[model samples]
Target: MKLPKKIKRYCPYCKKHTEHKISLVSTGGKRSALKHGSIERAKKRGRGRGLGNKGKWGSKPAVTKWKRKTKSTKKTNILYTCQECKKSHGQKKGKRTGKVQIENKEKKK
Candidate 1:
């Protein structure tokens, strides 16, 4: 599905309809550097105490470590800003729930 570059939605802060620009936000470069160092330290620590479970038993769940295959994006909220009111409101992505509809077919006798 193609995501909207700009979304028109209700802004509670502005109390009106607004257009929000959707873009991928990234952490500042400095923060990324800091995270890199922290991850390296964590890897080093894990190597010594078998914390990462890399070399542990391959088949056992107990030895398996949960790891994210993909890095998490910094996009936290869907931002809306009213053009007339010039006010903004942000809603977290997790707050929205999706619904799945199933169609039922009737049999003819």
Candidate 2:
């Protein structure tokens, strides 16, 4: 969806209204591989090696990668940076969208 690059919003730090910049917040980084209780760590410890039944870690029928189903859109967040205080804050809830664009200004209708 199209959005304005700058918006007049309430700035809690400044305790007043100010122009804020808009930007899309990207999804966070991947999880740590060495974290406890991870499948990789368990396999490295020889837990799933030479076992009759690996229980929860047991191998199952292989499925094609393309067969996996996932949501077309992702939950995205917007960051608003206050021009006065230079402080940034995100929305209370995320918006699900396939695409997001922050234009310099809204087109005249």
Candidate 3:
């Protein structure tokens, strides 16, 4: 899907409509293993002392590449930056597409 480089959108900070710049919002970075309530932190604290059926904690069979199914497309999210207030906001919903492209003008053929 193709998107415009700039679009007129509502700016909450300015409390009015204004011209905004469009840009893609990339996925967040990897999570930290030492964060609070994380499984890694619990394991590090010697808390793996359960003796009964581990259920989800039990080891599972390894999955092969062919056995695992993955989606070919990804959900693309965009951000709108208010030109007047210099503030950026994101849409509530994201678009699912194979690819997203933003351009100011069409190339001359």
Task: Pick the lDDT winner.
Answer: 2
Rank all candidate structures by their lDDT, best first, as comma-separated numbers.
2, 3, 1
Q: Please give the range of 10 consecutive residues that has the lowest summed lDDT in model 2.
A: 57-66
Model 2 residue pairs with clashes: none
Scored against the true structure, residue 16 in model 3 reaches a CA lDDT of 97
lDDT of 1: 0.47
Q: Which portions of model 2 miss their true places by more than 4 Å?
A: 31-37, 42-62, 106-109
RMSD of each: 11.2, 4.9, 6.4
Q: Write the per-residue lDDT of candidate 3 for residues 1-109, one digit (tens) a residue.
A: 9998988889989999998999998866668868998666766776555686543333332345346868878888899999998999998888789989998874454
TM-score of model 3 (CA atoms): 0.63
Error of 2 at 27 (Å): 2.4
Write one digit per residue (lDDT tens) for candidate 1, span 1-109.
Answer: 1345556677776666676554433223555433654544555555335445544332233323545334433334444556556665555652222322222333244
Instruction: Score candidate 2 by TM-score against the native.
Output: 0.68
lDDT of model 2, residue 18 = 98
